[model samples]
Target: MDDSELQAIRKARMAELQKQQGGASGGAQAGGSAGNASNDQQQSVEDLLIRLVRSGQIQKKVSEQELISLLEQLSQQESKANKTKIVDNSTICELTFPTSVLKVKMNRKRLLVILEEQIYIYSLKNMELLHVLPVRSNPRGVCGVCQSPLHPFLAYPGNNPGEVIIFNTDSLEPVTVISAHKSDLAIVSFNPPAGKGSKDDRLLLATASEKGTLIRVFDAVTAQRLYEFRRGSMPTTIFSINFEPTTNKYLIVSSATETVHMFKLGEPAKARLRPSNSETEAPAASANKYFTSVLKMLEPQRDYTCLRIPTNGNTGDTSSGNGKTKNLGSANHINREFKSAAAFCKDMVVVVTSEGYLYQFKFRSPEFKDGELVQQYSLKSM
Candidate 1:
């Protein structure tokens, strides 16, 4: 059946299940009886979803938000207490901790909880506490989890500055550790796995340091340096780093500036395995850098295309404005003057700003070099 037909079936089945459960909840007694009925209702919804998946009426890799919406619908008539715990039904698990949570990221199989100083990994099947990893001062809870079920990896900051620890969530062990930069890390992201699911495909990770001048893509399995894209010379806080969802060919980076950069990942540099404590520069390299600084300036890698959102509304200047582009660098705890984020959503480039504006641009295919502003709208009430 087509997706729309399958969705109709899912809605009909869920509505039928909701009606039956709604009638059952009416006569439920208070205290333990009400709790038992609530649990039964949650399980009934779960069973209905399972049958739909088995019957090929629902795709296993559907959006998590849609599943959560369905779960909330099932529990909408339950007690307020039960409604609070609806996430348990959607995720098939729940976790409680003594400390406040810094961040939470999950996929189909595992749930990762980041606290102030420690990280917890748990199985979604039974809420089994799998691993507890001690980390440094991660107040931002910087962590990247691979969404692909086949390439089950999780990346979090290591104990030292700019160190990234890649761990295999499936095997419950460490994969590799990469010292990505000389300064502290600001953002860590993994490229979405290729849609074709090849056995030879290795996970690719992208990291931006607090320096913010450059973004490095690495081989997650081998701890090798692959490609580095120079954002700019000036330092600014990077807001987001996102790889295109399906092909993983293009990377979108947003920062303190109004412009959003999209880099097409062409061929990468020769993979060089990083050595431990390799911070010192060689004499020949130092001499070359000094001469390049004194005589000719070094050329940095340029972005394939960029979109600069108009500060005013649709009447503002639409051109991406020419000049030397800046890197998405660190603001060093300074208040961001401006903020924006960009990502590839289907065939269009989507940009959203903190000033309450959403912009969409369409790019010509094949080369994908230029962008045409197709839509713009204000998110705030004027």
Candidate 2:
């Protein structure tokens, strides 16, 4: 080859090498950011995200081994500033009572509490019982009275006709028996946010039974049935049902299958009225259209091995319009985002295994799109 042709080929090879080095350096920085997402300021995250622009794909073309190499590169760029690690082999909590605790939640103040035979409302601040309330449930974890974000009163499915016995927290008595469903209801919930209902009277919930694979919604105060959606033909044991409190229009329900379904609460009310001037909503909605969910900060679905939604607020409609069923992001995607860490939830998404172990995650997500998953921790760890 002539001198000119050889010189051109050398220049092309040099450019390709430069491109590879840049990619390597970029990957290292991204790995570091993920390793220490919690530490990086908002400004740094913005810069990193710009560099690692991803090509959205239905399936992963990158292999795990190759991905790991890239991830290591990214990790190198990050400071690894949070070098302090907890070495305790023991868990954060020791099992005191051997009760097979099925339900556990935190209050608005982020107090870690568990509800088994009775309500254990303990204060996380000083590790003291703030107050104890009496609760009643059947073998399959069915009780009308439960702690939910929407309603102060706890309601669980009764033994008959999808019935629910509502209990007043202050009185600690079954004040009402509402036939919330036709079948034996497994759980009850509000439509999500408090007071988002028909005439502000209905509460939404889910009913699971060995009899069929279906979920039904009901009006808690009015005893009126709303809608019944056929979950599937499989043994309709609904494991988890979560209603977003602020939107009051989404339900994240997990069934016997490995997948979780997210349905948006549709605006079914056909009236126009002024919103109440509540501290959080009235002024905010009136001024701007940026109302966030109270439960948005809590983890959605982390421990798939065992997970449960604090069943309350079923007044709204869960209509991820068009009846589309899309698989939520994979576990790795969830871990990448939640790796940084967010605030804690006192009582929100919870689960309990057969070994009498209780699992909890404070569900938190920046966006409120249905089916978008945000896990608190790795399922493998639990």
Q: How many residue pairs clash in each candidate?
A: 4, 45
**What local distance difference test score does each model get?**
0.60, 0.37
lDDT of 1 by residue, 48-81 (tens): 4445446654334433343332242212121212
User: Model 1 compared with the native: what TM-score?
Assistant: 0.65
Question: Tens digit of lDDT per residue, candidate 2, span 187-299?
Answer: 45444434344344356554445443555555565444444555555654454455554444445555434334444434332121234556666665755532233222111
Off by over 4 Å in 2: 1-101, 104-137, 144-151, 159-161, 195-203, 267-321, 324-382
TM value for model 2: 0.41
Worst lDDT window (10 residues) for model 1? 27-36
In order of appearance, the predictions have TM-scores of: 0.65, 0.41
